[model samples]
Target: MIISRTPLRVSFCGGGSDLPAFYREHGGAVLSMSLARYVYLSMHEYFQSDGYILKYSRVETPKTLGEIEHRILRQVFEDYGIRGVDFNSSADVPAGTGLGSSSAFTVGLLNLCNAYQGRYEGRTTLAAKACEIELGKLGEPIGKQDQYGCALGGLNFIEFHPDDSVTCESVPITQAMRERLEAGLVMFYLGGTRSASEVLRKQSEQVKNSKRALGSMQAMVRQARSLRAEIMSDVDLIGPYLHEAWQRKRSLADGITNPRIDEAYERAMAAGATGGKLLGAGDAGFLLVYAPDEARAQVCAALPDCKAYDVRFDSIGTTIIYSD
Candidate 1:
């Protein structure tokens, strides 16, 4: 048996710029951090010799890799020539909550498959392979941030070059600053699950037509870089910086925010949240906010409909937790 665990991520700024539509021409960057929450994957030999059993929110028994209904599992199993195995998965958060759960799942699965195959690849290779499976093979209309974020497992500034190369640099934050940042930040579940594909697809198409939108995305990249630098010196800058990024983010696509999200943000701001934004590609998921000590209560009280989470940053990336 083999089990792998990976941390989900919270992207602070710079999102749309990572899409190939924009980055292939102008490059991109995102500042994000992994949380203690994780997606866990476990695999073992199946009792049956000629079939595979998979379990998650649902169960599937397929005689062939091609017969698997889950896309990432199917691709990973085929890539590794894995069969006659029973695979199970569990997570700290559900998918589509804007915490990069899908990428964490992919990274964890790849890590488990590598261990099962006795391959000792590092985080970089694992991230690259996962990206290849999701982006190059599956053709997901997403950016490279999540894969790298889940694999690297720290506060990072990730850069996506036009040449399709990615680089992750740890944010130079002091221990005190890290604690301060974590304390002031709050995540509230705004409900509903959304597949980022449609919004991302629309944003991708619009980038080619709207220079203004593309420019805004480019500016976001700069914001990501600046935020990383500024946060090291003063964590308090994050709130206003997040606000600035959020303003530009909503402009990239029409469906990124809806009436409910707008009302929530208004309420949060009224209650003392310095700034905040909907996590993920928008429409639904968690709403992340920056509220200082005095404002935290009011902010939480204002969002009566949303569930709150007190999550801390995680430094370890994906790891094989159990094996035999």
Candidate 2:
């Protein structure tokens, strides 16, 4: 049996610019961090002679990629030549929650398959391969940030060059800055989850035509790079930058925010949060807030329907928990 664990990510800035539609022309960058929460994938050879057994929260079956009903899993297996294995996958949080859970799952599953095959590759290569599977092979309308963030955790700035070269840099934050960020940030569940692909597809189509949207995405990437520098020097400004990025992010897609999400944002702001935003593709999932310790109570009170969690930034990305 082989098990691989990959952390989910919270993109702090530069969310939309990583899409190929935007990056292929203007290049892109994203600043994000992984969390302790993870998607765990366990794969083992099935004693059964004929077929593959797959298990996840919603889908379970003894079928190959073509035979399975879940599109994501089907594509995943097909890309990896994973046929005739018993795969059981689960996560710390539910899927479609804008937490980059799907990418984490893909990374973890690939890691497990590599271990089973006795193939050793660095995190960057593994991340790139996963990106190839999802974006290149599967043709998913997504960006490179999620896979890279999940594979190489920590507070990082990822640069997507025009030539398809990806570079990961660690944010040089001081101890005091880390404390302030951990104390001030809060994540709350927004009562539902969403598949980011659906929203990203629309954004992709827009970027293929609208120069305005493409320009806006490029501006967001610049802001993200600037924000990373600020975070390393002075963490106090993250709140304002987060607000600025959120304002720009909402402009990328019309469905990025809804009444409920807007209400949550307003409540957090009213409760003394300096700023915050819905974490991923944004229709639903987790909302990240920057509230000082003293205002945490007020923030909690403001969002009655949501469950709040105090999370610290995870420095480790994906790893093999147990193998062989």
Candidate 3:
């Protein structure tokens, strides 16, 4: 049996810019951190005679590639010829919570498949293949940040060039500083989930048509660069940076923030949160707040509407936790 674990990602800024609609012309960059949460995949031969035994949120027993119902799995399995194995997946969080759950699973699945074939792929290769499978083959209208972020596993500045080349630069942060930053980040769970494809599709069209949106994304990329520099010295600018970035991000597309979301943001700020933003494509997900440790308690208390928790950073990307 071989089990692969990959961490999910929280994109701090420069999100929408990673889409090809924007990056193919202007390039893209995002500062993202890998969260401790993970997607775990365990695969081994159990009952090989009948078909492929799959367990995710649902069960599947498909004897042929065409019989598979999960789009991502179907494409990956067929393209790679992966079959006749008892494969099960479980996650620390549910899908569509803006924490890059899908990409985390994709990266983990890719790693598991490679390991099954007696191959071990590096992070960049796994990330690029996962992107090709998702953005190229599956036609998910998402960006490249999640793939690289989940696979590379750190607080990094990921760049998407017009030539289709990508780069991930880790933030020069010490462990003590990392813990300090993590402490100030308080995440509140918003009730509903959103389809990232729906949101990204709209934002893609907006970026192609509106210079205002493109310009906002460009500013975000700049902020991501600036934040990288600032965080290493001291995290004094993170709160205000998040505030300014969220304000610009709201202009990318409609429905990124709703009445309920706006109310929550206001309450968080009123309770002393210096800044915060919705973690995903934005209709609904976790609201990540930046506040001093002293203010975190008040921020949580103010948001009686949402469940809150602290976030931890993960430095390990994807690993075969158990292989034999």
Candidate 4:
């Protein structure tokens, strides 16, 4: 049996710019961090069958890659030439929560496959292969940040060049700075979930049509780069940077925010959150609050319907939990 685990991610800035529709023309950049929460995959050989068994939150089946209907999963297995394997997958969080759960699952499963074949792939290779399977093969309207963030598993600055090359660098900060950032971050679960594909499709269409949204997206990427530098330098003004990025991000798509989301953001701010943004596609997912440690409890109390999760930065991206 072989088990692999990969961390989910929270994209801090430069969310929309990673889409090929935007990046292929103007390039892309993103600042993100992976959390301790993870997606786990367990794969083993089956003596009696020449097929695959797959499992996730609400889906379970045994079949070939061509037989599976889930676009991402099917493409991944096909690209990896995986067959005759019994694979069971699961995650700590549900999908469509803006936590990059799908990417984490993909990275973890691919890593397990590599281990099964006696191939040890590094984080960059694993991430790049996952991207090739998803973006290149599946043609999903998504960004590179998800795959890289899941594979690298830390606070990262990712730059995508026009030539389709990506560069990922870990953000360096002192222990004191790390502690301060952790104390100020408050994550609350919103009441619903959203389809990222639906949101991203709209953004892609707009960008393809030469809309102002693309320009705004580029601006946001630049802001993210600036904010990342400040955070790495241990600057105390990270909250305002988050606020600026959030304001620009909301302009990318109309469905990114709703009445309930607005109410939650307002309440969090009133309760002492320095700045906050709705994570993921915006119709539903998590609201990330930036505040001092003293203000976290009050912020959580203000939003009684939401559950708060205490998460820290995860430095390890993906790893083999066990193999034999």
RMSD values for the candidates in order, in angstroms, are 1.0, 1.8, 1.1, 1.7
Estimate every model's Cα lDDT from 0 to 1. 0.90, 0.85, 0.89, 0.83
RMSD of 1: 1.0
lDDT of 1 by residue, 198-223 (tens): 89999998888998988888889999
Ranked candidates (lDDT, high to low): 1, 3, 2, 4
Candidate 2: tens digits of C-alpha lDDT, residues 1-324? 888989999898899778887788888999998888999999888777467788887556654467887666677676667767888888988989888888898788778878878878788888998898889877888899999999997899999988888999988787788888888888999877777888998887877778787777878899898998888777768788788888888877778899988888998999899888889887888999888878878999999889998868778889998977
Off by over 4 Å in 1: none
Per-residue error (Å), model 1, residue 115: 0.8
Query: Candidate 4, clashing residue pairs?
Result: none
TM-score of 1: 0.98
Name the candidate, 1 or 4, with the larger lDDT value: 1
- Which model, 1 or 3, shows the larger lDDT? 1
Candidate 3 C-alpha lDDT tens digits along 1-324: 999999988888888888999899989889999999999999998577557888999998888778999888888878778878898999988899899999999999999999988988899999999999999998889999999999998789899999988998988788888888998998899888878999999999988889888889889989988888788888747888888889998889997889988999999999899898889888888999998877988888899879987789989998899999
State model 1's lDDT. Answer: 0.90
Candidate that scores best on lDDT: 1
lDDT of 4 by residue, 1-324 (tens): 999999998887888888888888988888889898989899888654776666665554655567887676677667677777777777888889999887787788789988988989899998988888778887767778899999997789999888899999888888898888888897899877777988988877876775677778888889778877888775456667677778877877778888888899899989988887888766888888888877888998999998999868889999999998
